[model samples]
Target: MTEILLPSDPEVRDRCARSMASKAFLTVWEGAVRSGKTVWALCAFALYATRSPDGDFLLSARTTATAETNCITGDYGLLSLFPGAEYRTVGNVRMVRFRTRQGEKRIHVVGASDIRSYMVIRGATFGGWLADEVNMHDRRFVSEALNRTAMSHDRRHMWTLNPDDPGHWIYSEYIDRYEAMDAGERAELGGFAHFWFRPSDNPAMTPAMLASLSRQYPEGTPFHTRYVLGMRCVAEGRVYPFFGPSCVAEPPEGVRAEFASIDFGSVHPTAMGWYGRSPDGAWWKVAEWGPTAEESARMTVADYMDVFERETERLGGIRRDRLTIDYGGGGEALVREAERRRWYPVNPDKSVLDGIQATAMVLSSGALRVSPSCRRTIDELSSYHWREGRGETVPDKVRDDFADETRYAVSTFIEPRIRRRRRWSRT
Candidate 1:
């Protein structure tokens, strides 16, 4: 590791000034992975930390170790960037105390992870705040940090993170303010300005880094969009970050059992998917069929059942015990129909967020594969998202039945133990 020299790039220099001078309560740096965002963010915080600083300041991340490793300990670390700073530990917490021409300054290191995360820094009134990988933090903790920072006359914040889903709160809460400010509709900076960084912006990044990224994420993947182009796009926010051609394959011959997953919708398409699980604990979507919203309106319950039976038989032999259908939407008719066929009513793990995470876990590990013949399922997997204020992982309510059914399959089979985990796995 080498000392980080602040960039002399004119655009970077200009943006740094704009960010520091802005009146916004929060300034955000978002872009490609391994962009110089962390260094840029530290620069902004350093300025706030020492320039006539008042009250305590905060430097936080998703965890305390990350904040220390990323900013405080490395060669270009915060202590190195500002050599005169004094470091000490108070009780369980670590702090950096420094001097400004106007006064003394302190930056307390904290970690923000969940709803109760604000407790770590609850009593401190910070003049400034900075958090790395801000997207991984709970929104409540972020809000609390901002609220606490109001104590300072020179209130500033530097929140940094890799580009994430378009629906992510950072875009709505911080990035959007920059947009409104740019459009000349706002008189003030609104305590929000965002600087985007691409990997190429960092002089240290070599051609080898680009090649490794291409090999890991490839073009046309969500990872490429967020990490390579550094664009905050719709695809970046997908629930399944790794569903694509690479995961499409024929069902393996080691198939132990076959099951059908279905989502019922009278106004929406009723999606039925066949999945084959390998004895080694892998799964593949062997086939999928669903009716369009228009066709569903004309079809009677009996007609729908007939279609389901025919599709089931077409995919070979799927036993009644192996069929699962979502209990939401217009599922009553489907449930009744399934009962007539002597099949069990499918009641899956109803926690929508857990289900989405479970699906992502499977897809990311390459444990779940989709057959090319299951085109609709493949398309839905690529597009399902977490939108509407971060809690809900919903689709646009159209062309999503297959995705919903897959969620059932995922919640039921992929992480049948989600009840124990209770939240998305950070690992």
Candidate 2:
């Protein structure tokens, strides 16, 4: 095994100790992003695997790719804890084989994203399970996964995740119930232990890093409250609360790249935005266009294409690969038409919350700005809000065409560049 240098932070050390000592049926480390909870859980699981009963163990995340990245091959992942660990595939299942003090152990890695993913473990049994980002998994998959380990002599499960809505099934069904139970009650129902982690709990986070992360998710925003403080809160109020006068500016010269994004609609108004990225990595929304209700009602794919061409030419003709469009509703037809025209239009990532979060972070950091002439886009930015009275956190869809288009542009084009820049800076 490689030499491991543990941090000296008392709280972090205590959490690590608790993880290794936990005898509960379910051990959960829930908290903020970069809180080191996943590392702690993985370390604990590594210890458990050595002495665990002779049965298959499972390691899972929201997707198989994420499971492999975060658990098996990540910097502080399971394989890193075991020097000779190697991944192998048995049929459709992926497993990590490693020798421990007792004997060789095999742990299967799986994705628990889809509700139907439970079928993967339907007939299989596991001695224990380690699930990263468990809250993102479907409730059906989670329930079934826990049942898969019920027959094992050492039936333990470790889960780590960032905070979500208070009403999320993971919170209400497990965390809340575990917290509300008395000691006697908890003991009778099989032990459950929950550990809360904050960004400060991560020893690797320097003061400068914490300050930078804090600036990305400003205070008084849902992203800050949930991701920074590790609180279970629903997104409310304006989606782009930081999009004030400062976020509205004229386009800069010497642009490095330009792109356009569209939110297509036939009944509703179609919205399109032309965006440019400056050399310093800031994004500027240069122009926006939308058809009136009457025009949208009568417009065919060809008409829309004509308008797109005119707008593209007017805004200095963006490359075909830079075009992003929503792939739902009438947007699908628009994408096909763009392809037929020899333009390779890409579909934007439609994960609403993730896109919204990325957009908000850039806007808050002043890395994203919109032209004052794009009046409709600016209006949507200020008025976009979370839907109220909904059990889940959902952005209200009213008058959000321009907002969706902006999100598509920023998330599809700007976010990836921002991530690349950050990684480069780190290196």
Candidate 3:
């Protein structure tokens, strides 16, 4: 048997021990990111599979790639626990084959990203199931997965996830229900065990790492509240609370205007921004333009194109490849017109939460700044608030035209470069 070194954190060790000993039908480890929950859950799953009932096991994530990366091949994942384990793909199914006390057992890997994911596990019975980032999976897939494991003798399931909004379906349906149940009620339904972990619980995290994370997600912010404190809370108030006088500045000298991003609209204002990069690699929003509601209603695609060409010329002409535009709403007409002129505009990445987080990180790190002349952009920054009661953290859509363009420019262009630089530095 291979020796497994456990974290020194007593709480983590105790939870891992309890997970193996518990007679729970469902076990959940939920909390902060990199909080050792996945490691603990994987360890418990390894133990469960050794003696679990007479059926194939299931291992899943929001996507197949994620399932493979986080659960099977990650540094602290299942394959690490079972050294020399064989992983293979047969037809549509990806699985890991490993020796157990009973015999060789297989764990099928699947992704439950959408409603259609339920079809992947429809008729198959599973002895046990282990899910990573269960909150990202569709509710229908989660329901179908649970049903798939109903016939096993153990019928146990383990789940791990970072904290999401309090009103999320996973919380309202499973976590809340479990917490609300009386001790007798829980016992009567086999059992449901839950564990909470904070970053401090992860023995692998260095003090410096914790400090860096604290800086990345500042205090009183939604990211800080959920990720650092490991709390499920609603996101309210200003979305970019960090944007203030420090973030607004005159365009720095020797800045090269690199690209432009457009948030096209017909009913709402059509917004655009010219972004530049300084010698120090910092990003600056040098200029912005948008038609008023009245002007937007009267402006045709030709008018918008003329404005785009004039603005591009004023900025010394940006490469067509660097231009990004929102493809939704009335933007498709603008995109087609631009293409006819041989200006291929790339579609912006419209992932709201991720874009917001990346934008926040850059702004907070002083890597992003906006010219004081961009009044509308600055105004949107101050007024952009989270949409309440949506059961998810989302920026309110009203008056968000400039905000959307800024997100497109930063997230689509700058954030990936920053991530690459970070990765390179680590390597």
**TM-score of each model, paired residue for residue:** 0.56, 0.95, 0.92
Encode model 1's per-residue lDDT on 318-411: one tens digit a residue.
Answer: 7787777777777887788879878775676656645665666567657788888888888887876645454322545556778888889888
Whole-model Cα lDDT per candidate?
0.73, 0.85, 0.86
User: How large an RMSD does model 2 have?
Assistant: 1.8
lDDT of 2 by residue, 306-357 (tens): 9999989987798888899888886888898999998898889888888988
Error of 3 at 294 (Å): 3.0
**Model 2 off-target regions past 4 Å?**
2-4, 253-257
Better candidate by lDDT, 2 or 3: 3
Clashing pairs in 1: 24-191, 24-192, 25-191, 165-237
lDDT of 3 by residue, 162-188 (tens): 888889899889878988999899988
Runs in model 3 deviating more than 4 A are 1-5, 86-88, 99-104
Superior candidate under TM-score, 2 versus 3 = 2
RMSD of 1: 9.6
Report model 1's TM-score to 2 decimal places. 0.56
Q: Report residue 206 deviation for candidate 2 (angstroms).
A: 1.3
